[model samples]
Target chain A: MVLKHIRNLKNRFSSIVSRIFRKKRDIRIGLYGPVNSGKTTLANRICMDWLGEEMGSASVVPHETREIQTKEKVQIKSNGKSLTFNLVDTPGIATKIDFEDFLKFGLKKTEAKSRAKEATRGVIEAIKWLDRMDMVLVVLDSTKDPINQVNITILGNLDARNIPLLIVSNKADVRKSSTTKIRNAFPGYDVIGISAKTGQNMKDLYGSLLKKL
Target chain B: MNLKIKFIPYEKMKMDSFSDILRDVKENTIILIDAKLKPEEESEIIEKTMESVSEKFSGIELSSIDFAGEEEMNNFERFKNIIIERIIGKKRGMTIIGPAKIIHKIKKNPKELLLYM
Candidate 1:
């Protein structure tokens, strides 16, 4: 009878351990930036490294991402805790153009105007959603000058809302890139230099995000 | 000295007039036109805007120069000369081109201009 009780206790303990290991915690992270700033590349890299597959493709065309794309069920281990993340990749924000401007891209004047209006609204929606995010990653192109109107506007809005942000200086492997300039442009903010193509400094990026979260 | 710099966007300007606006600007004050306008258009608008102030400050001597495409060194020289000759000596001020390249050019001389960015 004592031997039978010991075997039953071992089975119960194994069941409890399996239940705990099977459970997953959800964490939502938003990726945001201006047009052509490499938000998609970062998202893809994160997914590939952590999830073992690319979440999406990266394009050179401006506003290639017309809508928000999300990759869910990504499991990441941080601080000895297993957490699942729903990575949200958003469309690029650009100046609103009129119907005539859209027609230049081969759309009907009315259609172009409507699309432009939607694009404008999309940007506002994405920005407003920042308030609901657990964390935000603001990707900046290191090759460009740090003083851009769009960047300043985005940074100001994020700062005003007091949202926790990580400035990811993308394209670090490119020649003539100045990550220092980017860090200086926005003071007192956490900035990381990462090359998504070569996966350089990505582990550090993940570690920083885990720490912040 | 308290220098008030008012940056008026180009889209907001009415009557394309600047002279009447400059009449109210205090001496040693900086008027920054924070607009993405063409160089020639900005030059013409600035001249017409500060015409009244130029005449009133005849004793102060207002000398204006337009900075279109000068390099960093040349731009700094232009600004330094304007401050000494037009602003201090004449007691009247002149309007430089927009975008504030003068400030940026001067910043390069320092080891780190990141603090200001």
Candidate 2:
């Protein structure tokens, strides 16, 4: 009986040591795309689906995300290991450097210029932070033409950096928006058309993300 | 084929103004708009215009062409080739080209077919 008890004790001790010594893996993911392409909506969906609570707000305004928003300590089970994610939502990439445009959004001229400058800095930050991310979700507006400068620029940057990308085409419920056009625009990238509002194709998105992870 | 086209530039009026342009484009014709606005602004405009257009032309089918900036000119051939390779023989529909630079290129090219928007 004493020998059996000692054997159990050894097993418990080794399990504790292994648990203590196990390496922890954390993945950084950036939700990036043009403004109003539903980055916040996608981020909120991810937080809600994975964490059982919404973490971000969706807005119809352009440049709704003025700063970098982060949701940390998100855990996912992949490859039989517990993987943590630091999901970041960044300001949308603008194609032009127009400060006057911000004035239409109700900001004063100086404030608009400052916001534009902040947005420019945010774009640089988003691009530079590409190296730190394990995977990127380049969101696109499905209800419009896919050959956008911002989307192309971001895609080019990701290509240059050799980062794996998953193109999330939002607003799939819009009838005239063609996902096929978007797919054709980006020749050799993994693209998925999903509606963040209706949760269409979100399961597939999750599955694709899991595969990438 | 009946083709309609619309063009909006970055330096011109606000991107939101393009929604009216999209509305003016004939049904079943391609609607193209400049994508050179600030990323967030462009996205917002596109989203709003798309929502309106979809509601107005519920059953009509349309094609759209978004233009990348001048920095992507070298890559233009690839885009044109893709359109030609994917669209030329299979579809004989209307082509709507937008973004000033792309429209300028299209106007210069041999495909000089004109329509109204």
Which regions of candidate 2 fall more than 4 Å away from where they truly are?
A1-25, A76-83, A108-111, B1-117
Best TM-score among the predictions, by candidate number: 2
What lDDT is reached at residue A46 by model 2?
79
Number of the top lDDT candidate: 2
What DockQ, on C-alphas, does every prediction get? 0.02, 0.02
Stretch of 10 with least lDDT, candidate 2 chain B? B53-62
Mark the 10 consecutive residues where model 2 chain A has the least summed lDDT: A15-24
Lowest summed lDDT window (length 10), candidate 1 chain A:
A93-102
- Candidate 2 lDDT at B60 equals 19
Indicate the residue-level lDDT of B72 in model 2. Answer: 43
Candidate 2 clashing pairs, residues 3+ apart or interchain? A94-B39, A95-B39
Error of 2 at B4 (Å): 30
Error of 2 at A41 (Å): 1.1
Q: TM-scores, in order shown?
A: 0.54, 0.56
Residue by residue across B9-28, what tens digits does model 2's lDDT show? 43343423545554554243
Error of 1 at B88 (Å): 30
